[model samples]
Structures are given as C-alpha cells and as structure tokens.
Target: MNILTFDVEDWFHLLDHKSTKSEKVWLNYESRIHSNMERIYKILDNTNQKATFFCLGWVAKTYPEIIRKIIDKGHEIGSHSHLHQLVYEQTPEIFKKDLECSIKTIEDICGQKVIYYRAPGFSITKKNIWAFEIMHELGIKIDCSIFPSKRSHGGFPSFKNQEPVIVSYNGITLKELPINYYTILNKPIIYSGGGYFRLFPYYLINKWSKNSKYVMTYFHPRDFDKNQPIISDLSLARKFKSYVGLSGAATKLETWLNNDQFLDVSTADQKINWNEVPVVKL
Candidate 1:
C-alpha cells in the first residue's frame, strides 16, 4: 500500500547545516505553520485523502489547536521528536527524553497514543540504531526513519534494502518503513520526498512510484509555501536543495494524489503481515 505522510515543522526548522539561526532565535521568525498546514488540509480535504502527520513537539506545543484540527479532520498523528534534532546527533538518553517529550506533548493535545515515528531528515543511521530499542521501550511500534540510501544529514548506506522490514534489537521488535528510492546507474536515489520531490519531474516520479510495490511519500509545510523567506546564509547547494521547484510542488502533489490511493502508516501497518516480512537483527 502507498502511504502519505507529512512532517509538521515550520520553515525555520531547517537542517543544522542549512540553518544559521539557533532554537533560541526561532521566536523572531513569523510562524507560517498554521496557514501552510491549512493549505495542506484543504488539498487533502478536496482529494478526500487521509494522511499521517509526524509533528514536531515544539509545533504541537506552539499550535495545540492545529494538532486538534488534524485529529478532528480524521488524520493520524505521529511524533517527529520534540526538537528537530537528528537521531545520530543525540545520545541515547537525550533521544529518549526527546522522544518522551514529543509523545507526551502529542498525546496531551490529541488524547491518542502515537505509535508511529519519523526522524527529522531521516537521520537514524547505523551509528544510532540503538534508538530503535529505546523507541520500542517507549512504545513506538513503527518507524519511517531509515533512509536506505545515503543522505547529507544521516542515512543507512549499509542497509541495502529499500523495502519495509522488521527490525529486532535485543528482545524488542518494531516495523520499519524505510523511505523509498530507485536505482539509477547502480546508485540509489530517493525521489519520494523533500528536496528530491521538488527537484525531480513529475513524470519520472510517477514512473518510480509505478515500479515500486509500495511508496511512502512525504511532504513538509515549507514545500508548498512559495512566499517563505530564503535562508541567505545557506550555501548554494543547500539553497538549491531547499528551494528548488517550490512553485510547482503543490501542483505535482495534487496530480499524484488524484491518480493514486494512499493510507496512513498505522492503517498500512494493519494491512501487512509482519511475521512474513524479513527481519533485520540490530
């Protein structure tokens, strides 16, 4: 099944290397999350599609009504961490604390247990595989954090498979739905989300989606906002990755949604047979 998800963070929640401002300075920026999310809500409402939103705890805390609105509209809620810290950048203790904070914040706002998670920038790499164990301990049953291919922030380059699998650590097991990628010239390239989704043509993305058995497509609020102020301090490469195809993203997403069916992570999980899936022991 195809899964539609959104990482609910603001324009200022840029990756570390791409951002010049610190968390303490984030309050200075005008928040656009509500309006941008409203745009997304309208699209999903028009299309009659439901998605899972992996929200930052900060966003949840800052905009509790938005969190309630998501649930009110029948969308699933998942945690995207308290802050947008990369998984590998945090120690186990810090990660657990952040996870707990995010879970509590979301649960407090929505009154539903959050069992799905997606790391910021898909940053759960081999170095921090232990984070999964912590997640299991904390009651997260599914993770969409493993970018099977290499990424600038963090990725599981050693994870050769791009499909969903069960990962067992110690005595704990959780389902992993790694971001989708396609091979070109023997190099795995991810076009399902973020900058890649903006950078690639719609036709090519459709082709890749058609070829894959399942696609986990993701979007962010910033992707559809054309008026967001540019981060001038970012390098040219980062600039291109962050802002390229901004004007066309919403159109592309609409076209894709019109042609395909998507399920939330939790619903998609229910449709699969976990026992039959391959297991990766960490």
Candidate 2:
C-alpha cells in the first residue's frame, strides 16, 4: 500500500529560521493555496487517484467549500495544526488546545470527525513524544507526523523504522504511519518528501517505494508553484531547504503515481484490524 499524502498549507506557513522570529508576518498571506490546489485537484481528478489531505484549520474555516470539495472528490481529510506551530515549541496544554481546535474546526466544516493528524514541519520528535498521548486523548486515531530520520528542523532519527507501526501511549493506541526511509550500509536514511524528494532523482524514490509496502509521499501546495514569491532574508540552510527543487517535482510525482498502485491512509487503515494497536516500547 503505497500512500501519497499532502500537507495543505500555504507557502508562507512554512517557517524559515528568520521568519520564526516574528509570526505576525503569517497573517499577511491569505489563501495562498488556491492555484496550486486547483492544479493538484485537476491532476488527481484526471488520474483517478485519491489521497489524504492534511489541511490547516484556518484554511478550512475560511474556505469551507474546499473541504467539501475534497470530500466530494473522494479524498480523506486530516488535521494539520491550526496555527502551524512546531509541537516542541508548545506546552502540552497549548498543544492539546490547538489539536482540539484544528479537529473541531475541520469537523465542523466537513461534518466528519477528523481522526488523523500530521504535525506542521513534521514536528513530532523524542522531546515531544508526549504529544502523541495528547492526540489520542483528543480522539485522533492516526498520525503521519514522525519522519523516520532526523532533519535540520526536527525528526525522530532513532525511531526511523520506515514502516507503519502502531504506537500506544498511556492506555490509548494510535497508529503512527511514519514517512519512508531506506537502509544504507546498516544505517536508516530518509529520502521521502520535502527537498529530499526534489533534489534527488525521482527514480530513486520509485525504487525505494518498490521495496516497501507503502511509500508515504508528502508535498506542500508551494511545491507546485514555481512563481511563489521568494522569502527575503532567509538563512543559508533555510534558503536551500525551501528552494532547492522547483522544476520537475510535479512531473516526477505524477510519473510515480501513474506507474504504481497506491492507497491513501484512510483506505489502508480500513483494511486492517485496529482492535490491537501496538504499544511503543519506552
């Protein structure tokens, strides 16, 4: 079950190290996703492919029809936090409130209980493992937050098993469908999504997907927009992370989707028995 997912945030929501200093700039950009979303919607509609879209609560609130359109078009909707803040940066109380708000807002708009979540910037790391327990308390059933290996921002490097694993926290069990990774020379290497998917050749991703049951691929709306305005005064690492690959990402992704049969997280979950979700060892 190769799964293709999307992190549905506007381009600007992606925080640069410079931008993190001031979040007030975030409100300047309103509805930065329509054009790219239309492109993606048309592409998916033409190809007859369905995916899980982890969208922002604020976006869903402003454009309720977009959520309906996603449901009507036969895709699953999941929660990507309301404010797009990193999990490590928030206190547990604030984190839980944001999770609840996001779920509530999306559910109110879409008229369905949002059960899945993907943290902003893949922010679920060892330091914030407690957040998963908070999610389970909020009735979230699945999380696509844990990117297998470490990145500059945040990730679960030691926990990069590169497979769908159920992680039980407290007495609650939530399925954690982590991002894809490859084992190279007795080391786990992450090669899915973000700049990694763009900078490296697409064939390598296809090859990696062939080895795993599910290739969890994710892209932001900004990935498809080459004309997106450049962020001024970004750090060196942030510049590379945000703007490395713009030319052929969509085409490469389309090629992969055309060649293989993949399932969204919702569909794949339906096929499995959730009566006994795994308990993550502490």
Top candidate when judged by TM-score against the true structure = 1
Q: What TM-score would you give candidate 2 relative to the actual structure?
A: 0.93
Q: Name the runs in model 2 displaced over 4 angstroms.
A: 17-24, 273-278
- Quote the positional error of residue 32 for candidate 1 in Å: 0.6
Per-residue alpha-carbon lDDT of candidate 2 for residues 42-81, written as tens digits (9 for 90 to 100): 7687667899999988778767887898898889999998
Residue pair clashes in candidate 1: none
Report residue 16 deviation for candidate 2 (angstroms).
2.2
State every prediction's TM-score relative to the real structure: 0.97, 0.93
In angstroms, the error of model 2 at 41 is 1.1
Rate residue 127 of model 2 by lDDT: 89
lDDT by residue (tens digit), candidate 1, 1-282 = 789999999998988553422567677789999899998998898788999999999889988998999999999999999988888878999999999999999999999998999999888988899999999988999999988887788888898766779998888899999887888898887898899999999999999998989798889999999999988888798899999999999988988888888888878988988888889887
* Reference-based lDDT, each prediction: 0.89, 0.80
lDDT of 1 at 237: 88
